[model samples]
Target chain A: MSVFITAFRAFGSQVNIWLDTATPAADGAPVLRQVPGWLADIEAALSRFRPDSELSRLNRRPREWADASETMLSSLDAALRAARITGGRVTPLVLRALVAAGYDRSFEEVARAGEAGDHATPVPASRWEAIQLDRAAGRVWLPDAIDLGGTAKGWAAQQIAQRLAAHGPALVDLGGDIVAQGKPWTVHVFDPFQPETPFAVVALHDRAIATSGTDYRRWGADRHHIIDPHTGAPARTDVVSATVIHPDAVLAEALAKAVVLQGSIAGLDWLAQHERAAGLVFDRIGRVLATENFQAYLTQTQTHTQKGA
Target chain B: MKMTSTKRFAVRTALVTSTTLATVIGAQALASIDEAARAQPIPAPTIAPADPVLQPTTATGQPVSAAVPNVVILRHAGEVSAPAINVEPQAPARPSASVVSGSAAPILPPNPVQIAPPAPVVQQVAAQPAPVTRSSR
Candidate 1:
């Protein structure tokens, strides 16, 4: 099979689209061309960094029902569903907490300003249940501000991959939340400390993979983007990163973050409670811990590496 | 069991009077409980409004009330069957002992490229930036 690959920056991380087909020029090019535009539209609607975006407008509006676009409504629905399934371990209502944690600006701006080692007090808790959605009217009511964050990327990846699958086998990677359909594609779980080597490689088909880590997007000591709702602060856990594989990219993203917050052992156990979900966690000490069935998806070489290790 | 008519009438009157008095007392007690309950303040609801003004539409464009309930519960198809097992914590491998191919090279080229697979190339993982050399912290 011939593979056509494209990469660009979107959603604060690199996005890569891979289409496998018999004819790259004939089949892949058309489908691939539309992806960037689609991503731009999604980013425009869901980006919290953009003051004029739909999300920002919703956040700024008073706590009352206001008109929203279909994209905004659906993204909010996905975020709520994630919160429901994870029991608020993963929530979109972390905007205030995120800002309080010194992520008031875009990661790019934060990094460029050398804002590391600065910390802020934890913010008060926000509830996802307070956000109300009227799907028919295309209206939404926010109890407070929210940040779609990685959830938007995962949802967008799934949507784009589903659209591209009509033509041929496809994989959409929006900054690490990946969705693949039609055929099996090999995915490598990168070691957080050592990005050069993969701790595990697995084959996925009609599935999604997501990794959440504190190693990136760090602006302060012990401060990261993944916030625990209970504490309303950057999560403090022994696990440095958590990678989850599931049928939905959105859920995978949520579960991965939830796992990191819960730490390795409890995180893996919590991940096991979800049907068709598997996780691999990297602790602060560089030791790898994976769910039992995680090995089922491992490629032969990765299994060999496991045995040798 | 048999009694004179006057005696039977007297007994019946006494039973009727007691039953009426008991009923009156029971009714008064129930009324007082109802008043007490009404006087108590109702707690504020923790959830959204029971009847959300925004409703989901059907495919036929008809408004379907109660279609979107106040609380949405996500339902998965299958039961969670797998129990979490603790895998032995694998130590970092030696530099020369890395088994995966294309370890040093990046996954995507600067420009779009088409290639046939057999060689393992690193694809970007979710929520992480592209693997690049970074300055020491």
Candidate 2:
């Protein structure tokens, strides 16, 4: 089947939508056109970088129930689930920590500035249970500020893919968080160090995949976006990157970051506990490790090539 | 006041007979009262059905068929439905067996070649770009 692909920018990353159909004009064009608007709506509600965003307004007032939009409520709900599934390893209440680590502005600004300004001491994330959500009332109460970060992106990807799937088979990629539905799509797992070489290529069908790493978005030594909740600082670990595949994009994103924080050995062990979830971790020494079932998703040609090489 | 033994025995028997008769009559009266109470219908609370009160009607005055309150709509696997009121939002369904289970046969591509940077180099027939970690660049 011919694929109709569209690319745009949102959530501070390039967004790509792929529909498996030959007739773009008849089948996929209209749906593709709506993606940017949908993503913009989500970003307006969830982006922490925007001072006028709903998230910023909620963050300004803590310890009280504030009115929220459906986007805000649903995204926060998804974030809380991610925290629960990861045992608080992945949390939305890391805004203070992120700000302290000099990520107060957008990554573009931080990158262009070349140095993070002096900031306050990092405050450790509060318990995820402390944030209260009343979906029926369309309200949320935060114990402290939160940065949805990759969680929101993953959620947006999943939402878009679900919408597009009604027209045809679809794949939505918000940066690295991806969701594929309706058919098997081959996805490559790239080497964090090399970036150009793919260590493995696997087929994903009706599933989602995400990669989390410290190799990018660094402004200073030991400064990265993936914060360790325990230390309230950038994660100090031997694993440079981790990629996880699961049925849900939100969970995949959370699990990928959790793997990076826990490091390779313990992370792989943790990933095994989750049924039908597989992961690959690349350590600082260039060693590659994958969960036992990860190989099952590998394309046969890639498997053979690996064996021959 | 000494009496003959036969006289005393007759008096005692008479007293015992009266007392037995009175006890039997009292128990029978109590049983009848209890049966009467059981025969009465219990009064139920006077609550009216909520549909007529809360449900809105169409322009034609026909009552709209609203979703039954407290009734959850169950959907088939992978089917998306409107969120039911009062139901906790559930995580997306687990992937189907075709996704999680190992592929039975290898899907061989026609030929593979390297693309360029930003996108993964390897291209197999119709394969899409592999998602990389998010970077500012």
Candidate 3:
């Protein structure tokens, strides 16, 4: 298979783009080159760590009408929708809570500093209804501090995949928040602790898959980025990692984060109840449990060799 | 299973209240409002709750359904056909992979890491497109 693969760092993680086509890499270079710009725009608009970012400006502003770009508006719309769908389990109004949890800076700086968290009590997220958007006016009224975090990343990936799909089959992976368009793409899920070893592999046909866990960026030994909106503390989930597959990348990412925070029982139940999505949840003890419908996407399940086989 | 509109609103309101308290207190010494709400036995619902005994616990030592009740009573859309993606493995290849074509046979490179006893194998299976039976609204 002739494919054009490109990788770059963006949004605090590696962004991998794969275009499956018989054409030369140059044929797809123009379309591929445009992806980074899209991601950079999203980062500048939604990143909480950037004091000059649109999200930061909104967070600092009074509860008055503020001007917003198309990117910020759409991202906020998706974030609020996710908050509603998850019953506020995944919220955009967690910026203060996130900073209170010691994630005030970029994840890179946090990891490099290795500073022990001050163990601040978590403030529950603000109400989703607090955000008012006027699309026609290109303005928004944010009644509380908000953070778009992974929602923007997933939305950006979806946009890139949709755009590139017009040219050819494309896969946009923004740090494991993925969208596969135009063709089926096989992806592997590994143990979060052992990222190199594969636990299961699934094929996505015009679908999206997102994995959220405490493995990626950690400040103190136990302090990771996935914060519970209810507790304001880092989520204490039995499942070390939760990967959700859905037709929408934005929805998949939101559900993945909600699943990790919900733990395995509610997580799996939520997935099972959601007819359009499936998921795999890995617990802290190496036990793997998947939703009933999740097997449909499992083209292969890589397992440790049987003893003496 | 579906929850009564009244019950759903109550749970959502409780959650919103808990959240408001957290934000108001600046996340410093915020009280456990969910715990307080859960401590008082909630009213009996028209529908039987999913057996709590069967629920799993988190590392925090709380039941998965802790505090919030009627979590299983979600609003689902009508059944949708699952996407026709082939999940069956076709090529013998290394486990550590980034991307593979859906239609073409993947080229297998040399397997580098070899452990004792049984080799780590990619167990293949036949593809099955199951209709999705549930969804979150």
- Chain A TM-scores, all candidates? 0.95, 0.95, 0.94
For candidate 2, write residues B1-137 as lDDT tens digits: 88899999999999999999999999999999999999999999763343322232222334332122211111111221122122222222121111111112211111111122253121112544444333212
TM-score of chain B of 2: 0.32
* Separate DockQ for every predicted complex: 0.01, 0.04, 0.02
The CAPRI-style docking tier of model 2 reads incorrect
A193-267: candidate 2 lDDT, tens digit per residue: 434345456688999999888766666667888999987998888766788899999999999999988987788
lDDT of each: 0.68, 0.70, 0.66
lDDT of 1 by residue, B22-56 (tens): 99999999999999999999998664432232232
Interface Cα root-mean-square deviation for all models: 17.1, 19.9, 16.3
Clashing pairs in 3: A274-B134, A274-B135, A275-B134, A275-B135, A299-B87
Which 10 residues in a row give candidate 3 chain A its minimum summed lDDT?
A300-309
Better of 1 and 2 by DockQ: 2
How many times do residue backbones clash in model 3? 5
User: Which fraction of the native contacts appears in each prediction?
Assistant: 0.00, 0.09, 0.00
Give the number of the best model, judged by TM-score.
2
